[model samples]
Target: MAVLPVCQDCCQIVTVNKNGKIETHSPEPYGERACNASGLLTGRVRDIVVSSALRAHAVRRSRPTTSWGPVRVHKSGLLPRMPDAAPDAMPAPKWLPHLKGGTLASVTLPAAGWLGVWLPGYAKPTQAYRVEALTQRNVTSAWSARMECWTVNNQHFLSVANALMRRHEKILVGREYNPREKCTSSCKAARGPLCTCSCHAKHHGGGRWMAGWCVAEEFGTVVDGSRWHWMITGKA
Candidate 1:
């Protein structure tokens, strides 16, 4: 079922469902009652107009809403529009320890300092041991080559040379787009895929339909998994 949100401007019922459908429903006769969708969790905005008191209770969706019968978006903010963490840089710590798989029950970082973790295949920790929690802060351990490196919310240290490890990595974190940070209003990105700052939102076009926040590589090359957030579009 779709989640319908109430609109304040024209007293319309709008909805942005989980199925990715955005539309507005019929409304009570104008001056008949009150229309106020004051606090609702909806998209940015959309303009709605009532064509006829008859169809006033009708429903519509997101198209070129610029022109529609007598219906009009008298108020601008009332338009029901549709749409919709970066970490440190450095090598794995050295003294983070090497657990081949001991009492690895939970997945939490062991120490809070700079540490290098070598589980087995990948340089990450979780992949190596059932338990995980390895971060990087050591600036003196020397940077390690990003060979067979795959980073996601968690770090798996499975061996790349092992078939199981490669397949497992692909299934676990084999995504093309990586998340870095949330795009705030102060962000400097125009809506669309042209964004090169590696910005992203909770939805597809972003919460702000007008502002874009994603920057892929320019050469259409695969980036280091850890840098996935910065990979948005192929360069010009």
Candidate 2:
């Protein structure tokens, strides 16, 4: 006798005999109704089974396998792993008073008297001012090539964070379009005014924007297993 698999959906038994013939049977009545009487012939049933098996195989093969387990793929790419926790030596500090207003720029203390500022990109005016401010005060400061942030002493961290916050607010105010403004065809065509709303920023590249706060580990604190916050600027 050949082992048969029961269809859990309909509680019907499907089997392939020794002679390579497929068969399905409807079990006895339960309650007032019998198991689904609907049935498929050998050829049709075999085709459905084979197709389902092939699809399952393909799906399994397509998944990315990691030492931990299989990871599902997303539209952007493979799903990102969770950021590692910050080490005891470097805890996440409270955001500066200026940054608490929900600005894009942020500061992290990777070590005592040392600050790391996350900017949208390298060589922006804000980054230049940060280094300049520290230098003007005769404090140690430089762009960390490895960490990708302007590292300065705590003596000027407050000033740099405040300046960047003000500059960021000014740039946002200078924009002709507000977040509440509806996106227009011109914005889509990249011809006329562009909206600063999240929708427009995501779809049309209307303007540069960054959102979401990051933990200390995601900054230069932990270094090895940290992931940056998702940036709407499309680079992330």
Candidate 3:
């Protein structure tokens, strides 16, 4: 518990007891020890130092080793969560038809056969139609045979997906379609709202866009344009 002095001649150290009696042999002659030596390094001091060191070590170990592990990132709801494949993972539209009757904006696969197609400006189904956007704009009657009218944009699509997911509904995934930058406007006579087009010229050449499917349910209306907005109604 004493801080002994080094010898000036031999440069060695020596330890002494309280009565000025040399306790350990060394080449150095240390100073005499006093009665009270509580502040000097002793058992309690060693224990405290060891405990502090151990605590610091434990705290360091408790932290995450790497910042790359389990990272939390915020994501935009509109964009579909594509896999980590090549940028051009989806090939050309060899399966989709080149029909000109109406611009089938989106064909989502809610499951199988549960396709939600959006056609803005002008699309008149010659046969039956069975779909309606929760946000049907000016349509007075709900078209049981055909979709009245609907508009969708990138943001609106994401909004609808979020709403449907919250409602515990599966997204209808349509057949893959290239996105088109230009969108057609459905007429006032049509049953739906002003539809927006998902047209990316460079990616999807012939006015095509990737389509996500959804079930036709009364949840909400999504405005399609450069800035999409979702107006939630009932149990969205």
**Which has the higher lDDT value, candidate number 1 or candidate number 2?**
2
What's the TM-score of every candidate structure? Answer: 0.15, 0.26, 0.18
Residue 135 accuracy (lDDT) in model 1: 29
Off by over 4 Å in 3: 1-155, 175-236
Where is the poorest 10-residue window by lDDT in model 2? 168-177
Clashes of each: 32, 0, 38
Q: Please report the candidate that would top TM-score against the real structure.
A: 2
Candidate 1, residues 136-223, lDDT tens digits: the string is: 3321222234332223222221221122222111111112233445555545434432222334322434435323222222212244
lDDT of each: 0.28, 0.35, 0.26
Report the C-alpha lDDT of model 3 over 21-134, residue by residue, as the tens digit. Answer: 322221212211111111122221111122454443321111111222221211311112212123322221222222232122233322112234332222243111322343
Error of 1 at 95 (Å): 10
Candidate 1: worst-modelled 10 consecutive residues by lDDT: 102-111
Off by over 4 Å in 1: 1-142, 145-183, 186-204, 207-236
- In candidate 2, which residue pairs clash? none
Cα distance off (Å), candidate 2, residue 125: 9.0
Pick the lDDT winner: 2
lDDT measured at residue 58 in model 1 versus the true structure, 0 to 100 = 62
